[model samples]
Each structure stands twice: as structure tokens, then as C-alpha cells.
Target: MEKFIGLVGTNSDNSTNRKLLQFMEKYFADKAQIEIIEIKDLPIFNKPEDKQIPEQVQLIADKIDAASGVIISTPEYDHAVPASLINALNWLSYGIFPFVDKAVMITGASYGTLGSSRAQLHLRQILDSPELKARIMPSSEFLLSHSLQAFDEEGRLNNGEHIEKLEGLFEDFLTFVKITNQLNHAHSINKKEAENFSWEEI
Candidate 1:
């Protein structure tokens, strides 16, 4: 089964973004496994301390490495991505590079009008950095604005339009993950073959 890591960008117990991720986990349960990764226990990134990676950080890194793709649910803070999320990415950037060539889909929920759109854009830039190099979904973004009223009492998204869009985006993202995995597998095989090639054999 294809596994996808869900990164919740907030530390709040009542975070709307967390709820959003939960919905996604259930929605995609049959298609792919979505494991929500908690960042609360991760220590702030430090260069010197990175030589001996923290156990929590290593554990999350291992999960990311094993997953076929990632989905991040973020909440905008002062028109920027949450510091907790950025800190987690910073840790991954140092030596892990778990995001390198990994397929990622970004979504967010906010009480504002833009639905964390600005924050998602900022996140895309960060993921595009040399160290991270994540491959994000190209066309659609799942943004839930006015999120307080977006969900029903049962915790499912109430807006039919939003649900339709999310379904489409998820389908596209799945295809993207499959294609990326195939390409990466082929690249690894080619690299191994080149490594074993000898001039005497040629």
C-alpha cells in the first residue's frame, strides 16, 4: 500500500488544520495510508546538535523516507507559514533531505478570507529550496477559508463545492505520486548500474 505522511503545521489542540488532516486521513484511508506526523516534540533546529540527530527527529525522518508522498495542512500565522512547520522542515533540510524528490500536496484551513493561501505559497517556496527539493502538486490547492463554518457537526466538510474540488485535487495528487515513484525507482536502478559499470567489461 502507498503511504503518505500528513504534516500538521500547528501545535494547538483545537487546531482547525489538524481537523482538516483528520478528515483527509479518513477520506483517503482505503486508497492510501495517511499517517499524521506530530511536530510538537521536535526540538528547535540547531547546527551543532545536528551531528547527533535527536531521536524524535530521526523517527519523523524515517517515516518521511518510507512514505510515498506527503500532505501538509498549515494555518497561516501573520501571513506566513507557522514556525513549528518551518522548524520541522529546517531539521529535515540539514542532512536528512527527506523531502528531496518526494511528492507533496499542500492544504490549509484558516478563519480568514484567503484560507491560508499566502502561507501555502510561502511553503511552496520553502519546499523548492535547494536542500528540500520537494515536488508539489502543480494545479490545484485545497484551501479552506472561514473554516469555522466549513465543517459539519460530524466533522466532515459541509461545503459540496469544496468537497468536489478536494476529491479532484486528491486524484491528481495520487497520479503525481505514482509517476514520481516510478521515475525515482528507474533513476535508482540507472545509478546502480552506472556505479557497477567497468571499463574492462565495456
Candidate 2:
């Protein structure tokens, strides 16, 4: 099956986080069809009781709905994930809940030694819910400390170990997606069976 990956980057232009996402794209070039979603294009989350959703928000929801899995490459801003990311999540959770039952993975990088750890933690918290099925890697495993020293001019991950780690994460994400999709299929089948069953005389 073709794996549909949605890459969400919090930057508008060239950024370390975007570079890292590009690297992942290269790694999964042939195996998956990757779609890049820019936070810059999205508007702030605004909820009104009787108002319709904006076209941009609907566009994002459609992308999330179409994707099989989501990979968020977030940057830390003042020791937290960007407001744009949070805003996007808020919009997604309001009515669409596009994240529900979706497989997700998060990787972060920064110039600081902590390497976006705080941001990743906050993201995990925000995304924590019964409906949002995510397979998050440990903080220790998904880090890019001193990212400026690690990547090349063409936005490639130079460290072989880091590349290997990312490849492993991608594999794990794919596995998780496959399992979840299969479970959904099984659930549908069971529901049909239950609904189609007829009453019998004892």
C-alpha cells in the first residue's frame, strides 16, 4: 500500500526544522508519497458558534483526512513549540478532529543543546487524547542537538547514526499506520457482521 505522509513544518522559509523534514523526505523518497504542509499558510484558530470554517482551515482538514500518517517537524520558540503549531492543532481538534485515530511521529531539532526537547514535550501533551492514536518516540531518541553543525548546505543529515535513527522512526511509523488501518478495517467488518446477523429461534 502507498503510505501518505503529511509533513508539517512550522517555518515559512529555510529553517533547521524544515531542513530536517526535507531529509526525511529524501529518506522516504521512493517508499512513500510525502506532502508538505506549511503553517504559514494557515490562519489562527477562530471558533464562532454560528460561523462557517475558513477555506484555509478546510484545506488543512482535507489534507489531514487524506493522509495515512502525520510527521510533525517542529521548532522550539522561547522553550516551547511555535504558536502556529498550537493554533493548527486547535483548529484541527475543534470540529474536524483530523488527528483522531491517526498515526503520528514527531522529531525536533535546534541550535541549543536541549534540541527542542521542551517543545516536543509540550506537543505530546497537547496531542494526548484517546482518539488521537500516536506512536511517539522517546525524547532521547528523537533529537537533533546543534543541528546547524549536523546538516549540510543542501539540507541533508550528515551523521550516519542520525540518518539511521530517522529511518528507524519512519519504519516504526509505517508499521503503526498499517496496524491501525487494519484494526479499523476489522472493526468495520465486525460491525457489519453484527448488523447483518438475524434473530434465530432457540
Candidate 3:
């Protein structure tokens, strides 16, 4: 089976975002192997002069680099993704280009009706940055609003409509990953550019 990384985009123990990823890991077990990667263990990014990542961050980066694709489930915080997710991305891009040209799918859940719309848009901009350059699955989004009640005791989404949409997007992502791998002719150049990238120069 194909392997994917379900990146939990928050550090909160009670995060619905984490629950969403867990649900995906199980619900999509037949289609792919989804390994849920957490960012809770990582510390804040300080942009160290040496450009060395924390041990845990490196381990997480390796998993992402090796994965066929990534699914990021985020929560809205101040109309944007949580600080923890930003911190994790910062560390991942400091010296490693694990996300370069990698297929990515953005999903978000929220207590409100917009379903983290703003946060998802912000994340898209971040992933499109020069250092990240993730090949995001476009024109598709899985937004789970009223997330607190979106799942049942079994941790599965209760809404048939939501499940239907999610299933379609997940299948789209699988195809997207295969198509993205074909666009890797410039992968080395992208990685080199990212490794030598600096904010001060731009």
C-alpha cells in the first residue's frame, strides 16, 4: 500500500484536528497507510545560526521526506494556523527541504461554521513559499465545521455528507501524489535553492 503522513497541526491534547487525522488513519487504512505525525514534541523555532534542527524535528522531517504524500489537518487560531504548526514548519524548512515538491492536502476543522477557512488559506500561502514549495492538492478542501460534534464516540465522523466529501478528496490526493512525483525533474534544483535560501537576501 502507498504510505502517507497525516501531520497533526496542533499541540493541544484535546485538539479535534488530531482526532480528524486519527480518524483518517483508520478510515483510509484500506486505501493507504497513513502514519500520524505529531508536532507536540517539538520546541519553538528560534532560527539558530547553525541551522541545525532539533532531534525530533529531524525525525519528523525524514518521515515527511520519505512519504508519498502529506495530509495536514489544522485548526483555526486567530484566523490562522496555530503557532505550533508554524513552529514545526519553520524548523522543517530551516535547513531541510523535505516538503519541496511534495504532494500535500489541507484539511481543517473548527467549532465554527467556516471550518477554519482562513487558516487553511494561510497555510496554502505558507506551503507555496520558496522554502516549502509543497504541491498542494488544489480546488479541493475538507472542512469539518462544528467539529466538536462532527465525530462520535468511536472517533468517526458522523455526517454522511462530510464523509462523502472526505472520501473524494482522499482519492484525489492519492492520484495527486502520483502525478506530483512526475514533476520532480527540478527536485534537486529546488532543494538546492531552498538549502541556500535566506530571508535577509530576499
In order, what lDDT does every prediction score?
0.85, 0.71, 0.93
lDDT by residue (12-120, candidate 3, tens digit) is 9999999999999999999999999999989889989887789999999999988999999999999999999999999988888899999999999999999999999
Best by TM-score: 3
Better of 1 and 2 by TM-score: 1
The TM-score-based order of candidates, best leading, equals: 3, 1, 2
Model 1: what TM-score?
A: 0.89
**Candidate 2 C-alpha lDDT tens digits along 1-202:** 4556555657457668878877777768877877777777777767666546677877876887788877888778898998888877766665455665566788888888888888888888777743243444443347888988988777788899888888887787777777777656445444344334333521
Clashing pairs in 1: none
Query: How many collisions between residues are there in candidate 1?
Result: 0
Question: Candidate 1: what lDDT?
Answer: 0.85
Over 4 Å off, model 2: 130-141, 185-202
**Clashing residue pair totals per candidate (backbone < 3 A):** 0, 0, 0
Predicted structure with the largest lDDT when compared to the true one: 3
